[model samples]
Target: MIGTEFIAQSPETKPFWEAAGAGRFVLPRCRQCNRTHWYPRGICPHCLSTTIDWQDSPGEGEIYSFAINRMGKEPYVVAYVALTEGPIMLTNVIDADPGALSIGTSVKVTFKPAVTQAPVPLFVVR
Candidate 1:
């Protein structure tokens, strides 16, 4: 496993982190624009609306883009996953051969448990 650290959560992103700890993946949605967004902020990036809601995601996505980090002893995949729910998430692609991945590769969400922090959301080849 890669290095893990406890990340601080704010009031706006508390629900998201808590849900992840409970094994659920959620995204922030703007009630005004009817669009989902990532990074789980309080306001919508699209319409700048403070009216937001949380929606459960299917946790399925496709690799939008990726880079293989070979500087370390083990190579890992860092990728942008285009979620099925209309958002692109910056995340890591785990449990797969780095050389086998390509743009548009199908992925499924999986969690990486942290020491003190909530479980992190990651993806694996599907």
Candidate 2:
């Protein structure tokens, strides 16, 4: 199983982790550029502005790309999910048949406990 060590929980990403712990999905939006970004940062990557703010995400997205990891202790699908709000996130897709996954398949966020700390977000087919 994946662990919290795989995730970087720093001041810059605290809000994201906090929201995930509460079963909510959030993304940072640049107030200046009006764009949403992943891998939360202090400044907008696009505009380099310090006006980023946390916003609740609808948690609905489509698979932008995917690959199955059959060599691991357990098989799992890793994917880039394109959120409805326009940001793409690299995440794991769980609780579904790997063969049934395809590009453009709709998915929604779900939270599961991490090995050492708060819950982390995963995606499920919807």
TM-scores for the candidates: 0.92, 0.92
Local distance difference test, candidate 2: 0.86
| Cα displacement (Å) at residue 5, model 1 | 7.5
How do the residues 1-126 of candidate 1 rate in per-residue lDDT, one tens digit apiece?
A: 332122348898898888999999988899999999887787899999999999998899899989999998989988989999988877889889999999999999999987777998889999
Instruction: Quote the RMSD, in angstroms, for model 2.
Output: 1.9
What range of 10 consecutive residues in model 1 has the weakest lDDT sum?
1-10
Model 2 off-target regions past 4 Å? Answer: 1-5
Candidate 1 runs further than 4 Å off: 1-8
Global local distance difference test of model 1: 0.86
Instruction: Enumerate residue pairs that collide in model 1.
Output: none
lDDT tens per residue, model 2, 12-86: 888888888888888999999989998789999999999989999989999999989999887988888899998
